[model samples]
Target: MKLVCTCIGCAIEASCPYSAPRFYLGEGQAWARHFTEDLTRENIVKGLKETNYGRCVYKSDNNVVDHQVVNMEFTGGATATFSMCGFTRHQERRIQIMGTKGEIRGEEGKIKVMDFVTHENTEIQIPEQTSGHGGGDSGIVRSFLKEVCGYNGSEGLTSASASVRSHLMAFAAEQSRLNNGQSIELDDFYKKLLVQV
Candidate 1:
């Protein structure tokens, strides 16, 4: 595989395009009702008001940081950088991966691939997502249900070990962010975390 570097960003725009009113008052009214204790409009509104959903994102009382940048180096010397921000004009996730053979970039369900050896560029458009999180939420649920019914779906989530490794990377990224962007060794971090547990 020999991937040399990867850059990923998850952005939430500050333009309030996804505001509570824009959602609850519009196409997401059905979704709002799903979370309400009752199907009544008044109850849904009250339920939303009781939570942070009613407030402007910028004016919310929550103090959690709106941006994070993480740099990581895998055991084999490949590196990755991930960033999250709430300052863009739109909410989206983008990724670029560079390797010995080629590079790949994707955003908004569209992907572009460049092959260094063949000097070819290819583009692929994923199906439009009707479900939340680019259809990932439903995909995982469907995959899980299939697995539980004594069937192994080919498109399910990754293996358990890979999932754990990815989660550990996230934890290490948070630890690094808290420590002023200090580089974290995954092997050592894994050992230390295991000891603490």
Candidate 2:
């Protein structure tokens, strides 16, 4: 039995994504917390490539101590595990843009754009009113149509720089998590995007 287990471990080590062998043999809390940082689709994919573990494990034999131990402690823990296993039910999609002129919050089928300079807040309503994505899709479509057709009467909230800044936040959050929750300097990221220019 020991020989078979050793062989399995050796095979896993050869194929594991991490630089070190025995990925699960270390502190579980630290690893779990690390996984929560960044927590984006791309980073999650990278993490999975390095650590391949089953999202769900069932105990088929009464004599298997490992299975029993896992079954006893694994209930709500399946969400993250399943997420790592390429079983994501939905993609997280949000767009919030803040500028000296105003701010825009977009999700689902609604988009609220606020202009701090002019002290004006505008809410774009979606006709479909879908529950998914917080009504962002419809709002986006409406805004796009109005802008493209010159019917909005004013400029849209999102632009190339604003989009880049929003995405940079996600990247910074991931970097901070990997660095033990140390704050990531946003200046470099912003400079890369040339946001000020």
Candidate 3:
């Protein structure tokens, strides 16, 4: 949808009309915080009262990457890539998964599956989401409570092994970005982090 929106903007205006909001997101109501807080008039005024987002995008004190790409390759040759960019016409996620027999394409709330052999297309409509991130905090909390209540084999807030691997991957990405895109071995990075701990 984001790509579509961007394309539409460009087609209609000869320029991407809704590209990364060219305006600066003020201090208290920083862009990142917008998703976490209610957008009351008072809050909006307060955020704009005293803020400095006027600095050029090329020049800022921010350490986080506004755009990045992470590529991972497994030992047996499987690979995956994740790319993120703040410059989008809309706030939407799009993904496509392909397999030998079929393929699935989806965004935040919709999906379509295509079967190779039968050439059938199936549309999947996601039910209403009651939680942010498609039931994020709610799901995690419920899972945690279930585990606390003695539920066996519960995936409570991500498995410890998975968390460790994810954290390691994130840290490695950051390190790689800072080091001019040098690849970092995951196992080696984990050992280094462990030593620090």
Candidate 4:
């Protein structure tokens, strides 16, 4: 449920209640569209991407957050917190989940699931034989359309009803960030969406 990327950091750079840059491109920089043209050093240079790329990452953007902590409390009193920053060596996601009976932990490749009662630990070996990662997207779309999507048929990949929960959570997070990390009430936020829907 977490999306971490340069775009997230860039968003903070671009969006502040009062300090965001205007749509106009700053002088002597490549047009914004070129930023996503290609990652090759030559293309990146030509694109003249992100306005403040030449400046120190920490000092460039005006009001965006390079690092921040967000805390959330669910309706049933369960809680979650996440920390994000532009500084990291790895580009993949690692995750851990704890429950009353068992726990699951791992990154993209291998995950370990353990049962508290049985005391049995299982090791899942993921073999990609490339990228040193367990999984890669070689024929995922074909398999998906021929398999999962063939049955469900993209019913809710991006429908508003399917995405409302995540979208609302993101909105609340942004609101909380701007409000000095104040706690947000989900009920209050959801009600506002109801009116709009």
lDDT of 2 by residue, 76-176 (tens): 43211111122233334456766668889876667899999889899997565444445556666676777787755555644456667668766665565
Q: Compared with the true structure, what per-residue lDDT tens digits does model 1 show for residues 78-122?
A: 988889997675568899999999999999789999999999999
Model 1 residue 16 CA deviation in Å: 9.2
In model 4, the Cα lDDT at residue 10 comes to 53
**Rank by lDDT (best first):** 1, 3, 4, 2
lDDT of 1: 0.72
RMSD of 3: 8.8
- In candidate 1, stretches whose alpha carbon ends up further than 4 angstroms from where it belongs are 1-44, 55-61, 142-158
* Backbone clashes in model 4, listed as residue pairs: none
* Arranged by TM-score, best first: 1, 3, 4, 2
Clashes of each: 0, 11, 0, 0
Off by over 4 Å in 3: 1-38, 50-59, 154-157
lDDT against the true structure, per candidate, is 0.72, 0.48, 0.64, 0.57
lDDT of 3 by residue, 60-89 (tens): 455778789988887887777888997774
Clashing pairs in 1: none
Question: Alpha carbon lDDT of residue 157, candidate 2?
Answer: 48
Q: Highest TM-score, which number?
A: 1
Q: For model 1, what is the error of residue 182's alpha carbon versus the real structure, in angstroms, after optimal superposition?
A: 1.8
